[model samples]
Target chain A: MNIEEMTSMERVLATLCHEEPDRVPFFLLLTTQGADVFNVSIKEYFSKPEMVAEAQIKMQQKYGHDCYYPFYYASLELEAWGSESVFYPDAPPNAGRPVIKEFEDILSLETPDVFESPGLQKVLKTTEIMKKHSGEDIPIISVVMSPFSLASMQMGFENYLDLIYDDLDRFKELMRINESFCVQWANAQIEAGATAICYFDPVSSSTIIPPELYRKTGFRVAKRTISNINGPTATHMASGRCLPIVDDIAETGTAVICTSVLEDLSEIKTACKGKLSVLGNLNGIEMRHWSPQQTEDKVKEAISKAAEGGGYILSDNHGEIPYTVPQEVLTDISRSVKKWGQYQG
Target chain B: MEFEDTLLSLNRVAAKNIISSEFTGDNAFEVINEIISPTLERIGELWAHGEIALSQEYMASRICEELVETILPADAPSRKNMPVIGITTLRDEHMLGKRILSSFLKANGFNLFDYGDMGPESIVQKVKDDGIEVLMVSTLMLNLAHEVKKLRSSFDNEKIDTKIIVGGAPFLFDRNLWKEVGADSMAVDATESVEKIHEVLGDAR
Candidate 1:
């Protein structure tokens, strides 16, 4: 086969090594749309592990992105630890009530066993299913939110942050507990057939907290889980605030740092060098309202700035492609990338 | 015992020091308006300018909430027949922004019922049942525009007269989105929300 049609796994591996792949790799932190591809109700799709796996496979086959991120976040590690939550067909899950209603509750909470938890089991099962269906050449990115983001779900997002300020000791303790779970779960996903672990770490982003404090708490603990993982780790921070901390996060040994649409690509390109792959940085919000020509223009611009040295992949900013993105607009992105992201060598 | 000291203590995340002031409930509202208000705005500005982390700003909000709850009167003499208003995040979750909106509306003396996180049916049913004069919907995700539109269609079908107000990141990013989704008005922040609520309830000064 021609270099233009390299497998996604080859494409990703090439980009990681800072080599010129046939074309720029594409990353989609895709979920939610799985239901649409399978023509199943969102409720039916999210509830069954097989249906979920099927949805992800269909999406992978259809989108043909370099890295297939198949994640359905329902507060996995936190739910295992007794955090109350409810998931809807339309959106992500949230805490039904704060698990640690009082600061003292953190002291008594113990991390659940990876083998014995429903949430962990579901994640493992999904990975196994995806691995079975995805050929050897396809790279499956197992999605794991960082300890800090999961901690936000355990208590309320705001309450979790307030506790960080209100009681640093307790917050550290919580991080210790949550990080332990993340390590177990991430390794479990790896064992169950994941090629790479894509961790969502938005809570530590500059959008939510300062780099100094994030480095102290969420970033520090989140890094603990990633550092312990075996191989090919990708970390995603979805807020524009992630810009200021790119160097620090890159220092954490993540192979890829999927930034949101707000990053300055020139700064990221300069900062990342050969250390990490810069995926995403697509303006997912604004693109949802843009014309097809505008979408193509954005794809071309992102490629020109970030794809030059080879450690780059084009992608939608954070989360799924925007709700308003038509299939045609997505096609525009893929077409634009193929046209502009060619390797000269 | 001044409000600003307590809030400043909270700003520093000194949780206990905020309570040491020991003001009564009636006194709590006064300090919240005069002292906590500007401090919260400053905190917003800091977050906006990237001086503080997003999580730290959230911590400030949660701090302001805990401090204010101590002073929220169990029974502030209702504006006798003040128009009752309800607030919720349509469909999914985003509690802080809506919580801030509810707190501001309550401070302004509009009868408020916070529905927390709920789907369209529950929100519309409550507005219809409680005779909520204004239904305030706050959502962060762009997809939630459908939920807002659904609520509007429900209101129209039921012939409910309650005013609808929408806010959050999406509406703020695209000003026309609020109108397109069928909301009656939109606010940029808690303070502007209070003014919008006043206008919606026909109590604008």
Candidate 2:
């Protein structure tokens, strides 16, 4: 494979297809951090789709990462359900208070049109803008929250868990409602020009739930949602451990699985061998303090473990990189990937 | 009714029945300290080991909280002389850790002021105004966990002697994070929080 001639989109696509790209593709997953790059507050960054698009392009160009996305934050999805978000000067916005204050509220819940919801509209518009600017060179990875994960934000996390154990039927009913919105929103992003859909579902992580509960709930929901998505899909657990359910995640039909830092990269690669492509395990929490040399060492290690097989994408373990991580470290990561991610004949 | 099994399975009715039939006002504290606390600890262990789902641990804690509230006498004199403790989610809204710890502390007859969610400045101000001796801060994200360092500095500037205890995913992920964030101690779960408070407040309490 002549790696230098490959575009970022081709590089990522080649990897997803289990073929050697020019080099191992790397994604920064710079979501809220784009605000910092754009020199705007997080609140202001999400307000304008143009700003988000421009920031994403700038970030990819600056870091030389293979992919960029239009995700602002997970809570942005909750806005469609009438939940307000609390923005910060530094961090990503969090869902203010749960919309469903009581169990009965789920009955009256209506799935809002994705095109009509302001937050969802902004994401779709951002995707369209990125598509227009980047064209087919760079891949635009759009994100959609899995129904089970979004349930925690819809109601309180504890309340959602309570609903699961307290009234399994009601919880399933809630998941049904959330699944509709997820499908609509995911398809809308695809129509807007997303290269692939990243199904963000942290709740299904073995760290959060046992595999049995996941098979009964999140697994079913994800399989159905991914089947309905218009584009290829990657299952992301937002840095939650997925080794116990790696097989189940592969069974969900996603093209790739974004693993967690909590698990060993070599083990993850071995588990994902032929079932799915792997995209992560870098410790985002520790990335903030890594020296340039340390960052390079980490990158080299990840490539050595997973990149040789030709089905890996280097990225921070958590879906989104923290805004606190220094620019120098990110640059080092991209440089190191280019240096050591080459495939030998 | 098997109290531990009832809480584990999340059978609230069975749990309530056990409390009504087996628990009396006199044995309330003993029941909480002996039966309820240990059962929740086992559940926490199961959760930490990935043996049970988080929902089971959370619902178990919730059920235990309800049972504790029902059995414990509200006007118990032991609640008055305990340290003035305050808990809050520092700049992050993920409340499972805070809620669980708050309930666990309250069940132990500690006077706790649940500050729901607040920024660093508000938290500092509240800590000073409430004269909280031991402040427990819970944050689910790493950046928010970093807020504890800023909070610690604020407390220092104000010359407040409140000892800070942090518990959350970040602290658990990074074992030394508590000390790095200037917290006096870090508790892995609610059960450990009680012991940490005792250790943090030593002779001063």
Candidate 3:
């Protein structure tokens, strides 16, 4: 079989199966440090379509990553609802506006419009750029904020939790608005040629909310949004506490599940079973700070545990290291994949 | 009866936070002062009854820093007759109990020289150079608790008479840790911590 003629899906499937691909595919989510490493700013990368295209190509060439996300995070959609953001030189822009100044503010929030809103349009333009250069050679995955998280952005993180107890209806209304925004954002990305949508709900993780509330408010919205998306959809809850909700998340029509530092990989795979792909639980912090060999060991261990079937993707579970993770370490990980990622079963 | 009632209330609050995960910030100071402090007065009631789990109590002390974020005053307090206090945590520790204490002392009309998260050497230098009237060090983890003793011994070595006040989860629970550290005194909570400082200042004056 000619691997070159196979679609991006086929290439990804081959790699997932631990089979020799046309080449090993690597994923880059154009984070701030990632953009800086490629000599581009967030503004420059997002503003000029060609700049984004050039950076994506450069990052792919520079790191030889299999998957590429054009932009880093989905919280930019929060700006559509009149929320504020604080940008940093090296971090994902953080929401500055507390969405819920008062409990009453939730009732007045309208569902954000992705097509017309400025922030959403920026992402839309970025997605368009991603589609143009993707050349059907690789998948361009995009992310969306979960409803509960977007609600936190709308009402502010601390205030949203406080308001949940004081007022449930208004909180539910805000959640509905957040859900609408997620759908709107997902649809826009799909229109702009996002191959798969990645839903990231850090707030829905157990550290912030209890398990019952997660299943009740956040899980349902996440499920519905993934089901509504046209192509493959994956959702990531960045805390281990979300482990209990893994089965529930699988039922949400996601093709993939990603988690952060605090999850047991085997359990996540077991929970999702045959329903979805299990991406990663490699400690990103370790990769960033450890020696190249240590980083390779972590990658090897993660692959050993996660690579039983052709469903696991070797990647970090959280934010990329600023300057610490050596390019050589990443190369070593990739080389090890080619060396060790054979499906014996 | 009053003292018993306060202890009962404090226990109830502590239990609610631990068991049900219900955090009530309302009247938190009163709960800490009227109940938590008085309960601590009962020899070793806090550690004995396990009202303070190692993690939760340490976290509670850290949350005191959050209170500072919310309770920033519009204008700085007057420096007249204010005591100068130096606060630091042990090396590489991120627990914010010392930070919280510094914030409160500054808010309550004390001039603070906050060395932030520092080693014993850094803390001693700050105390000496800043002419700090009281040297306050806090640690949460058991390993970093040794730095308190090192700070006190270093001050003794220099013959620099600085009042040492140690408070945090580790010092509060580990009864022998205070004597081992050779620090002048210790307090279990922010309210008693302030009172201890006042007593030290009165003696100095």
Candidate 4:
């Protein structure tokens, strides 16, 4: 199968399940650049449905990337919980300051309804538009927060850690609620015709939390949620140290694992052992920060090492950072993927 | 109490806020001044016993900086009579402490200018442009302390009468190196920073 001949469904499922694809399918955390390149600001994109749809279309047509991500994860969802968030026309929301002043506040916290909150509702709405526009054309993977990451946003990471041991019951209650919202969000996307769901679990990475705590908290809810979902679910471990807990994460029943720059691809492929497809370990920050040639070299190196055992989706080690990863680097990365990522039977 | 408990207490103190009854942004530092310094000393004790993770200590330091943002006032009456102070980290770009010290001085009525992540020449330029009377440089990494010596030389050459205050994880770990950086004052935590700055600058009043 080649790019034009294969349907979006075939391309996604083939690559995610560790099988040969017509060609390598490319994806990105295209929220920031998609907005920039397409001329739709984040607030406008989120608040208005038509703007988001137009922007998604423009990013694909203009930039020629394979997939579209409705980027509402990091600060937006947390803002719905009472933290002050500053929004710029071009950039996604940034955490203004922590809202929960004391540990007691965590006990009283309530998870905002996904359908009700403006920020989250924007994501759902964007997914609806993308699903409609893509219309079985290309894969649309909607991103959402994992339980641990949501908790970190509610309170700062330190207070969140204390809650795990200091108040396990309340912690469990919060996770259950957040997980419920996540399932609802993912299911809504599936209904909207989304092919896959990407769960970005940055704060919960093993680098931040010990693997035991990660298993107890982040992995538990994640596994349950991924299992409940119908479409293929990809979990992003936003730190390199998560390699140790690969087995634990794989047990969550996710179809794919996208990791940060820290994990060496050689080690992760051996460890994953065909249990789950591995998507990344691209150096987004380095590539964004380094020269185009350097970017090409790193992408080629990453693709060479990771693309061997079938299930590999090439993207940055992380998502695109704002004002970083110059246009040339993005082009170089795309070129390298085409040059080196050919399937050898 | 356990060592972890003591560290948490310090974090709480450093991170405390006296959210004013009135809407105006000005806040009194009297409450934090009473508790934060002592709390930090106990945290230093906890770290000595290896009770807190290195990350936790770094976080505590960061939280102290965050707490300072709330404590400080945004609007200033004047910099004409007030002592002008500068704060930054060199080589290592950890803005947490620099932000904290900047906010702290702002709260206590200093004309504080932030020359963010600068080498010696840039720091000298900022000092000159801001008419800086006091300079504070921080190094989060141990190896970056050498930048402070370069900063001192630049200041002397520029004929600037600015008091250089050096502090960070590396300098705090070694007293001689802390002094060797040629700073007039230094402190390990945000609370101690208050006393250290006062001793070197002789009452910003």
The per-prediction i-RMS, to one decimal, reads 3.0, 1.7, 10.8, 9.7
Winner on TM-score between 1 and 4 is 1
lDDT digits (tens) for residues B1-205 of candidate 4: 2323533544454244322332144433443344433444455445434343323444554454455455544453433565667877763444445654554455444567777777686778888888777788876544356678888888888788788888765564345566766777777655466677777878745
Output the lDDT of residue A229, model 1.
Answer: 83
Query: Per lDDT, what order, best first?
Result: 2, 1, 4, 3
User: How would you encode candidate 1's per-residue C-alpha lDDT over B18-66 as one tens digit per residue?
Assistant: 5435455457545655666666666656655656655554545556666
lDDT of model 4 at position A62: 53
Docking class of 1: acceptable
User: Clash pairs of candidate 1?
Assistant: A206-A241, A207-A241, A208-B53, A208-B54, A208-B55, A209-B53, A209-B54, A209-B55, A210-B53
What is the lDDT of every predicted structure here? 0.72, 0.85, 0.60, 0.65
**Candidate 1: residue A252 lDDT (0-100):** 80
List, residue by residue over A99-178, the lDDT tens digit for candidate 1: 77777888998888889987678768888988887777788888777887877777766677668776899888888887
Model 2 chain A, poorest ten-residue lDDT window?
A87-96
Instruction: Point out where model 2 deviates above 4 Å.
Output: A1-4, B1-6, B13-25, B79-82, B107-109, B120-131, B203-205
Chain B alone, TM-score of each model?
A: 0.74, 0.90, 0.62, 0.67
What TM-score would you give candidate 3 relative to the actual structure? 0.65
Fnat measured on candidate 3:
0.00
Query: What tens-digit string does per-residue lDDT give for candidate 4 at A198-313?
Result: 87776556655556667777888888888877787888865435676789888988877877665678777778768877777765534435676777687778777777756777
Among these predicted structures, which one has the highest TM-score? 2
Please give the lDDT score at residue B205 for candidate 3.
23
lDDT accuracy of residue A16 in candidate 2: 85
- Residue A15 of candidate 1: its Cα lDDT? 86
Candidate 3, A1-345: lDDT as tens digits: 765555555667764454545543335343554555557665454455455556666666666566657654445676777766655444455555465678876667677667777766666677787677775766877778777776656664335555654477887777777777788788788888887777877666654455566777677777776677777776766433456566777777776777655557777666666666777766543454456677667767777676665567767764233333456766676676655654442
Residue lDDT tens for model 2, A289-343: 8898999899999998898768899998888888878888888888898899876
